[model samples]
Target: MQTKKYTRLMLASTLVLAAHAGWASDEGTLTMGTSVNYSSGKYGTQTSTDITSIPLNVAYDKGPWTFKVSVPYIRITGPSDVVVGVGKTSATTSTVRTASGLGDVVTAATYNFYNNAEAQFGADVTGKIKFGTADSAKGLGTGENDYSVILDVYKKVNQLTFFGGIGYTALGSSAAIPLRNVFSLTAGSVFKMDEKNNAGFAYDYRQKSSATSAAQSELTAFYVHKFDKSWKTQTYLLKGFSDGSPDWGAGVSVGYAF
Candidate 1:
């Protein structure tokens, strides 16, 4: 069953790539990126737990639509008490558990419903799917699929852009943990420092997945530098404000567009 699931995911990804490659034009752009991230502290536990993940992303944009897909490989080193989804464990064992494998396959499609080039404002809706590609036995994922929908709006004024969004996610349930549907909100602004440099900050809040768990909140600052018309690099730092999130995290990514 696992083999079949992976095979289907790969096939779907390949088909999307092929379709985009054939349809790409001057009006459309394709971008590829890779990122690595590390974070420590599980839930509210003072335990020394950490997670590392490396993800590969592909995105395509054309006209008023955008499509994205991501595949991640992740490693978790910590006590098994750190339950997935709930983000907390009651066990006090000093023995750490390590798990590594493909994490999850995510795909999204966005359609711009409104745009005003002269006014520099636009709104879009995105639908996303999270496939359970990770090995459940390895504790990489919950072996269940999730879905979400988000609405985003942005406006540009001079060199600064303001954006915000809200979304609802239908969390998948596993034998080990039961999750509830959650709502999330994000708000931020970005400033273009020059032709090649940009900086932004965002705050995110999410409802708790379980009644016993606290809601999650985080703040992130990001910077992007364009190496050329076709290449760019991005880096970010994150600080979590709730037990359901990592205490601190950082990552860097390089992207190429064509």
Candidate 2:
């Protein structure tokens, strides 16, 4: 599933990580990373809202199984009606407000069903849960949990890798904030520039969580560089074509594996 800022990075990173973490490795690998992301948009409003997020992520991969978690601290300067993760709701206001605090916590587990080294084909299934740790009073989140299941597949041809996935999410709802279950899709390709670098572009789409909000559609271009066997970095720029997404966004992250 897709949200904004930090969530966007997680989705893209998952694809790249899966591509790099081949199924041949029987030993476990631990990875940790952090990133700073920023996005701004009107969300069909007269006044623009800006959001900044810093997320800490950790993941472990062993054989066919992968486990991951992410937590974010967010700062929002916008209308009180705008909600983090879900974006603008039915409520509207011209008054702008600023709030800062913890955002949502996300966790997931993935299992690789098949991988063919010679054929360069692989498939996986992932189950994800999003905990509403952010403060609802501050508009950081909806104060409820969300669940998702995704099926992803990839094919490698020479130095290029193509990947895509489809997912369904069950969003929790409350009296103050009603939400609907939605479906999401993502497709992308990564081109290996050399032994140490790669670049790619991905597109994400999700149905609207609320009747009033627009569907989410975004395009992101990313670059990944390996500093060494245990260290790596990633940078990305995002452009949104739908009212449900941020107008523009960017982020940088560094990760270590051991």
The weakest ten consecutive residues by lDDT in model 2 span: 1-10
Candidate 1 residues 1-258, lDDT tens each?
Answer: 011122222222222221221233548989888887777665756575677777787888786677888888878877666644346534345456898888888898877777777777777788988887877666676677889898877777887877878889898886565678888887777878987887887777788876545687777787778899899887777788888777787777777988
Model 1 off-target regions past 4 Å? 1-26, 83-86, 89-95
Error of 1 at 58 (Å): 0.6
Q: Give per-residue CA lDDT, model 2, range 1-258, as digits (tens).
A: 134544554454455444653662688889898888888887777777788888898988788888888888989998787788787777656578999998899888888888888788888888989899999888888999999998988888888888888899999899888999999888888888998998888888899998667788888888889999899888888899888888988888888999
Name every residue pair that clashes in candidate 1.
81-89
Q: Each prediction's Cα lDDT score?
A: 0.68, 0.81
* Pairs in steric clash, model 2: none
Q: lDDT (0-100) at residue 38 of candidate 2?
A: 86
TM-score to native of every candidate shown: 0.86, 0.95
Measured with C-alpha atoms, the lDDT of residue 190 in candidate 2 is 87
Worst-scoring 10-residue span by lDDT in model 1:
1-10
